[model samples]
Target: MSVPVAMLMAWFCEMLLLNSRSNQSVFRYSASFR
Candidate 1:
């Protein structure tokens, strides 16, 4: 609703998206290694 709140939410969502993407890549890499 407020500008700062919206910006914070957007940043948080981006962080979560990046973390999940990195985790997926790591899982795939480890699976291949096995």
Candidate 2:
């Protein structure tokens, strides 16, 4: 694969993992306010 593509794949994995945690935080905070 090209270098840029490889870099993007790595970044995507990081974004997915990071967003999963952030999503959970948002979900919990919203639930508490209800």
Candidate 3:
């Protein structure tokens, strides 16, 4: 694969992981308030 393509894929994966992590944290925070 090309260098740029690999870099793009890596960035995309990182963003997805970060989003999921944030979502989990939000859910946990809300659960704690209940």
Candidate 4:
């Protein structure tokens, strides 16, 4: 793997991690209101 490719993969993984974390927080917040 090249340097740029490796950086891109790392960035993509970070984005996915951030998105999942946010979604989980949102789900929990909504659940608390019920």
Candidate 5:
């Protein structure tokens, strides 16, 4: 429950979300190009 731990968790969640979005975008782009 420390501030640093909370910040780290938040950053991790944000990175996961970003990765998911990029994967979705890559899949769509590849499908369209093919």
Candidate 6:
């Protein structure tokens, strides 16, 4: 509910989304090489 807490949560979620997107791209790249 606090401003800092909300900002932290948003940052965390963004990091998670970025990580998953990178992982997916890596997976696809590797699959293409197979």
RMSD of 3: 11.6
- The root-mean-square deviation over C-alpha atoms between each candidate and the true structure, in angstroms, is 11.6, 11.2, 11.6, 11.6, 11.8, 11.6
Provide the clash count, candidate 1: 0
Give the higher-lDDT candidate: 4 or 5: 4
Q: Cα deviation in Å at residue 24, candidate 4?
A: 12
lDDT tens digits, residues 1-34, model 2? 6889877766765576577865665555434533
Question: Against the hidden true structure, what lDDT does model 2 obtain?
Answer: 0.62
Q: For candidate 1, what's the RMSD?
A: 11.6
Give candidate 4 misplaced runs (Cα > 4 Å).
22-34
Instruction: List the global CA lDDT of all models.
Output: 0.62, 0.62, 0.62, 0.63, 0.62, 0.62
Candidate 4 structure quality by residue, lDDT tens digits, 1-34: 6889877766765576577865666555544534
* lDDT by residue for model 1 (1-34), tens: 6889877766765576577865665555434533
What is the TM-score (0 to 1) of candidate 3?
Answer: 0.59
**TM-scores of the candidates in the order shown:** 0.59, 0.54, 0.59, 0.59, 0.59, 0.59
What digit string (tens of lDDT, one per residue) describes model 6 on residues 1-34? 6889877766765576577875665555444533
Runs of candidate 1 with Cα error greater than 4 angstroms are 22-34
Cα displacement (Å) at residue 7, model 6: 0.1
> Cα deviation in Å at residue 28, candidate 2?
26
lDDT of model 2, residue 4: 92
lDDT winner, 2 or 4: 4
